[model samples]
Target: MADILTVNGGSPLVGDLEVRGAKNLVSKAMVAALLAEGPCRLRNVPEISDVKIVSGLLELHGVKIDSTDRDGELLLDPTNVEQAHVADIDAHAGSSRVPVLLCGPLLHRLGEAFIPDLGGCRIGERPINYHLDVLRQFGADVQKRPEGLRLTAPDGLKGTRIQLPYPSVGATEQVLLTAVRAQGVTELRNAAVEPEILDLIAVLQKMGAIISVETDRVIKIEGVDRLGGYDHRAIPDRIEAGSWACAALATRGDVYVRGAQQLAMMPFLNVFRKIGGDFDVDDEGIRFWHAGGTLNSLVLETDVHPGFMTDWQQPLVVALTQTTGLSIVHETVYENRLGFTEALGEMGAVVQLYRECLGGSPCRFGRANFRHSAVISGPTPLRGAEITVPDLRGGFSYLIAALAAEGQSKVHGIELIYRGYERFSEKLDALGADYQVG
Candidate 1:
């Protein structure tokens, strides 16, 4: 049976919620522990299902995971890392594509890595072609079988220069994780410089991997002989922090998000303030609220770091439903992202999806037949409705929509939301959100 969230709308989600390490970074960081020569310690980890998924995957590969005395900390000992059984890996893989990342690190240690067929959310087609291509460049032989893929480094992995057509985060991480222990220098052009990626680099650096980032999105890595485990705290989840801020704006409530860093969220903060929302940033975190006025409609675009994040678009779109005039959002990251707006339209929001890129710039999806842009006409009052969650980010947006709606909303498939948001139900309860799980 699908888990349904019954949300009583019209009440503002108020009060304080704490965010932990990033969902994007923590999982990949856990995967990186496999490359370590010694025990590793990661701090500020979030208690999300992805962490558990990665933890189980690591244990299957014989990495010992233990808890530390400090809260939100994990000790990963990869000293006895071994190849996991194919059947065992397939059973414990869950729905994350993180196992694909095991190719590089496992190859370095065990000389061969077995990758199960990857799975993720239904947001868009995230082909592992980029990852496979990167692995091939590193001299790993890829063999496709009925079960999954088997990658063996017969001549040992070696680094080579490659340029990404697009700066895909997964692809970039694949290169980093693989290239760190490869035999030679690796130069990657058009690399993704997201904060999560940088934090992973920081972890890798502490593990004795030498990586340098150029201003023009080029990253150079000098392959190390071996990598020691790192003692590092993962970055805060900017996506989660921004989602809560948007929830505050959508419900016209005040929210103080602890552990939300200001520097990483500057683009979101700028956009929030521009929409007539208010925020105050301190050493601890940020407080978000409506500015007690009609929210202004604005044209926004989602890009890589230093621009509005694609993950931040969905929830903010919910807030735009209450804004005056029209708001245009161009989603450049994922082509199928605007598909989530249909649920909003059902709830009385005037959100229209367009194949043409509606923001100031034309994106890769402009020529393709995908609805990558959305035009929102609002000050439209939302009514109660039943909505099924599409993906992680989109699922959170549904909750924000339900909270902002006039009556009640039955949100089905809420289990997907737990893949990203940490302690979300309890956080909603702390904010006085009227929601119950069934």
Candidate 2:
């Protein structure tokens, strides 16, 4: 039998919830431990499936990891690290994009790496050409195979200059991980400087890696010969915080997200205020709610960093369904991110997808046939409908829609949500949401 979530709607979700470390950073940080010469301690780690996936992958390579779920602490030791069988990697990785990240650290440690066919949320075409190209620039040989890809550093990986077509977070991470312990200094142009990326840099620096960020998407890494372990408490998950903030607006409730930092969330907060959603920022957290009076709509665009994030677009789109006017969201990050709107449409949201960029400057995908833009018309009454969870962020958006709808919603494939969200059902329960799982 398939697992499902049944949500009874029309009630506001109001309560206090704590957000742990960022899903984006924590997994990469776990991968970073492989580069350490000794054990690394990571704190505030969220209990998400991605963490489990990375932990499993690390163990397969002979890294010893100990964790305490209650305290969210992880101790990863790389002293006995060794290569595992290719079949084992394929089995453990299973549809996760993390194996691609294992490439750099594995090459540095074992002088070789193997990556299986990668899979992630089918939200867009996330080609790893950028990653592979960066590895090749670092003097790693790439070979394609029936299973996936194999990489070897015959010349003992040397650093080189690289320029990314776009500031992709994953690709930038690839460069950082590979270049940190290389033979020479490396310069990366057009690199992503997201908060999560900065946090990962902090982790690397704590491990004795020398890295610097210059203006206009430039990052420099001075290769180090020997590195030690790091102790770090990851940055709070701003994406989770923003998702709950949108949930509050959609359900006309109030939610206080503990551990939510104001700096990382400033862009989202400014947009939330523009939409007539109210928020107060304090040291501990941020409190978000739907302000009385009709909600307003505005044009928004998703950009690399210091702009509205692509992950933030979905939940806010659910809130836009309750706004008084039309809202245009131009998603420049991932091409197919707007596809989740089809379910929103089924739930009575009038959202239309557009192939051309809508209300913002044309992006890289503008010439392509991808439907990367969305027009949402609001104040429409949502009715519960059976929905399938697509990806992590999209799944949570579906939950928000269900909570704001007039009746019950049956959500299947919700296990996909566990890859990022930590104890989501428990959080929903704490918020007084009517939901059941089986």
Candidate 3:
């Protein structure tokens, strides 16, 4: 039977809950474990579907991982890394984009690698072309196979100068993971300096990698012949922290998110304050709550790091539904992110989509037909509605909406929420949300 969540609405979520390692960084760190000569120990790992997917993929390639500990530590040993059958790879990689990242390390360790059909959130055309081009630039031979893509380092990978059209996080990770063990030096321009990317760099550096970050989005990596194992703690999930903060604002509740770092969430914090959400940050976590007043509507734009993140847009949109006046949101990161707002509209949010950028300067999607912008006129009441979970962020936003509504709401396909959120149902229960899962 499909998973369903029955949410009882009109309640404030008030309590303390903990957030573990980042879903974005933990998977990549698991992949980075494959590059080390010995076993790598990663701490504070989150219990999410993406981590399981990557664990299965690594196990298929003969990487032995021990994650039996309850304290969220993973000990990954890649001593017996060997080629696995493509069929097994496809089955284990089912609808995950993490396999694409395994190409460079596999090629370096085994002279060849195979990546099955990639799958992830249906937000935009996240083409693997940028990843493939980076691999090709690093002297990898790419060939299309029936099941998936096959990459071979016939001449042994060599580092080279490259530039990104946009600072894509995945492509930046590809360059970092690939160039670390390649020959000579690699200079990358227009790189993504997201906190997750920096955390990955830290993991690699612990494994004896030489990497330097410069001003204006430039990253330089000096290749080493070999790398040792690393022991590191992954960063907290800023996205998850922000999501819960927005939930507090939407339902006029108070929430304390443990392990949420203030530095990584500074941009989100600024925006939260502007929208009339109050937060107190300590060394351990941040406490978010509604300020018990009218929320101020404002123009917002979603960009890469140091900007209002695209991942934070959805939940904030739910909070914006209760704010006075109009709130304009320009999503510059993903083109189809605003589509999730349709369910919000069905639940009585006055949201309008636009093809042209309405809140900020013209982005890459402004001239296109994609509805990447949103205008939400709120102080509107939300009622219960039947909804299906979309992507990870969208799924959590739906939960916030349901909790803020006046009646009962049944959310189906809620298993998608587990892909990124770690034990969120339990967290909801801790927050005193009246809900049952079956």
- Residue 115, model 3: Cα distance from true site in angstroms: 1.3
> Residue-wise lDDT of candidate 2 within 48-109, one digit each (tens)?
98899989999999999998554799999999889989999999777589999989999999
How many clashes would you count in candidate 2?
0
Off by over 4 Å in 1: 68-70
User: Model 3 scores what on Cα lDDT?
Assistant: 0.93
Model 2 ranges off by over 4 Å: none
The C-alpha local distance difference test score for the whole of candidate 1 amounts to 0.92
TM-score of 3: 0.99
Q: 191-296 in candidate 1: lDDT tens per residue?
A: 9999999999999999999999998999999999999989998899999999999999999999999999999999999999999999999899999998897999
Candidate with more favorable, higher TM-score: 1 or 3: 3
Q: What is the lDDT of residue 94 in candidate 1?
A: 54
User: lDDT value for candidate 2?
Assistant: 0.93
Superposition TM-score, candidate 1 onto the true structure: 0.98
Off by over 4 Å in 3: none
Model 3 per-residue lDDT tens digits across residues 357-400:
88655489878899998999989999999999888899999999
